[model samples]
Target: MSETLSGQATSTISAVVGRADVLIVGGGLSGAMLAAQLLRLPGRRRILIVEPRAELGRGEAYSATELGHTLNGNAARMSVDPDNADDLTQWLEAFIAKGGWPESDQQHVPVSELFPPRGIFGLYVQQRLAEAREQGAVSGSTAEHVCGEAVDLHIDSSGARLTLADGQCLEGAYAVLATGMFPAARTRQKHSSGLNAAAIDPWDVAAMSRLDPQGTVLIIGSGLTMVDAVVSLEQAGHRGPIRVFSRHGLLPHVRRQPPAWEDFLAADQSIRSPRQLLREVRRQCAAALASGIDWQAPLDTVRAHIGRLWSQASDVQRRQFVRHVRPWWESHHHRSPPLSAELVERLYKEGRLTIEAASLKGLDEPRDGRVSISIRPRGESRARTVTGEALINSTGIEYDWRRVDRPLPQQLLARGLIRPGPLALGIAADPGGAVVDAEGDVSTRLFAMGPPLRGMWWESTAVTDVASQAKALAVRLAQLMDSQKGRG
Candidate 1:
């Protein structure tokens, strides 16, 4: 169910079929992690997870049916346990021994370096949640899966009341806005560019298969998503030219298992501004290359300090970073898996994939069973029309809450319950994921995590980051509940 927030207290509990101590608005990895953390705590708080999907833990990111769609991070770096870094590696090793993933041997890499399929990752998440559920059951802390969409939310001094699409209401002492990222291709838009209506989904290999096998494909945006589309095309037997367009036509750097370099950022305490950070990074890269080390080693070490650095930087510095460094930052930081990168490179070398430094102007009406789009090449004065047999909008995830054409985000903004994050990246929230309203007041009963905390924690979407946040947030919630118990 989808819900928009209302400021006034129409908080009626009538017809409420469900009541929980914690109401988790999303059942994706973030919600599942929160539930697991809450269950682990020494308390008996009831948790109700509201999600429309039939299965939990598999959000938009992991709901891939294609094995070609693999997680960007390898197992070692993607562990959900903060203290136990090799948790996923240990689980995967046992699972592979039991003939779970027969294709595991093809990677030929150590279990820690093998990037699992997104679907399999979702399965791993579900298994962890199940284990947590059993522990919770023994502790008398219950977790229920409410299979429905939330449409309306009302908050009062006592608690929050949520209304679902089926007219059923659910109440809870606290609510979490754990809704995940909204991919541009799948999400509806308030003001659209007609790209989504004409473009095919990035993961839909079946739809790509129906297209002319030898016809050209037009792809907008060149990032990890673009890499996925290229892989999808090859898997669907597409042999025609693939034209990729973006403002800055930079492909993601291939992820590598590079030897560890010294943690330069940790050793330096003066790196606060984006400029200083970039300069230091360049120096570290030069030093690493001079020492015959991969540049990625130094950059990878900076991942741990990103939230601290980004949050501490002034707004001017942030804008400067966005204007001057965002393109390079994204391309360098969000790297592609080796196999997918190899395919993209092979197709490009084979004269089948052409990348253009251009910006999409708009869409032209389809003519002769082909998709037409207007694009102005970089540094060009005029826009030209290009047509292809198929078009895929691989732009990436939509981060701005105000621009998200969803019922909940729209209502949240309308009601001033949440404000846009710095530079409108995502919704604004305090350090602990307490939502900040338009009037600059932090929310106590309402909190958020995961991708919704993009602005609060720049790298909050990563598996490790989400796990740490869940642990901290769960501890905070337990403290709040304990205080309430003391008062009662």
Candidate 2:
């Protein structure tokens, strides 16, 4: 049968089904990792992860069904456990030994160095979560996966109540908003004629497949998502030309193995401003290059200190960095896998792909079948028109909560339960992942992690960043639960 909590059922959809010590609002990697960490700790608390997806680990980024979509980082650095950095590498070795991958795929790349498919990584995450769930069962702590979207949240003196889209309610001692990256909002075209029918989601493979194989494709914002779109086209046997446009026309640098450089900032730890930090980084890069090392070595060293640097920077400095340095930093820091870069290079050399630095003016109505795009090339005032069978917006993830069209975020903003973080990057959160309300009060019943904590940690989206945050948040939440139990 079904479990029930001590709350009244207001609708026929369902009653308040159950209660948990910790209620997680997302089931992506961040939520899964947090749940896993909590399960490992000494406790018998119940954890309920509410997610709309059928599986827990495959969030938007890793949920791609395409074989060409692969992880940007290697297995050694992608482990869920921050303490055991090589856990994924070890797991991958055993997986290969047990014939986890097909022989044909295994022979093509070295397992340790391979950028495995996103789908495979998703499976690995699901497997880890499943194992953690089993461990929780053995420890008398229970973790339940609730398949539903959290539409609204209400907090009271005792705890917080979550309302699902289907009208079911769940009450928990504590709630975590682990909602990860939101899709980039559609650009409001100046001339909103028939352009609506021309734009399609970049990741929608079915929609891409429906396009004429020979028709030109116009992709907006040439970054990682643009690469994914190109790969998807190639996988679908698309042979037509592709034109990609963005403000900077910057493509991600190819990922390369770099030796560890000395941590110059580790001892000093005084650099707070982005300008000061960038100056030091440039100096180190030059020194590394002089010493026959890739410049990436010095930049890689900065990864460990990004959170501290971001936290210490003044709001004005932070805004300056976003306005001036974000584009270059993104292109250099978030690199493309070598294989994908090579594919893009090959296509460019063959004249099948064109990348341009330009600003999108507006989209004209679809004439016959193709859509017309008006763009002003960088440094040129004259506008030119280009026609494509379809347009895909690869502008990347939207971080500002205020602009997100999701129901949960909208409701949260309406209730003043959360506020915008620094520079309106994401949801307001403290260093420890606790949500801060509009009145600048720390939330006792509500917390957050993952991408929503980006304002607190500039590099929070990566697995390493998320894993460390998850571990720390899990420990903190466990302590809170213990105190609540003691009071009871």
Best by TM-score: 1
lDDT of 1 by residue, 89-166 (tens): 998999899998899899899999999888988888888888998898887987777776777777778888887776
Q: Report the lDDT tens digits of candidate 2 across residue range 101-155.
A: 5642644656667777788788888888888877887878866777788999998
Q: Please give the TM-score that candidate 2 achieves against the real structure.
A: 0.93
Error of 1 at 480 (Å): 0.7
User: lDDT of each structure?
Assistant: 0.87, 0.83
All models, RMSD in angstroms? 3.8, 3.1
Model 1 clashes, total count:
7
Flag regions of model 2 displaced more than 4 Å: 1-16, 103-110, 185-197
Task: For candidate 2, list the clashing residue pairs, or say none.
Answer: none
TM-score of the candidate numbered 1? Answer: 0.96
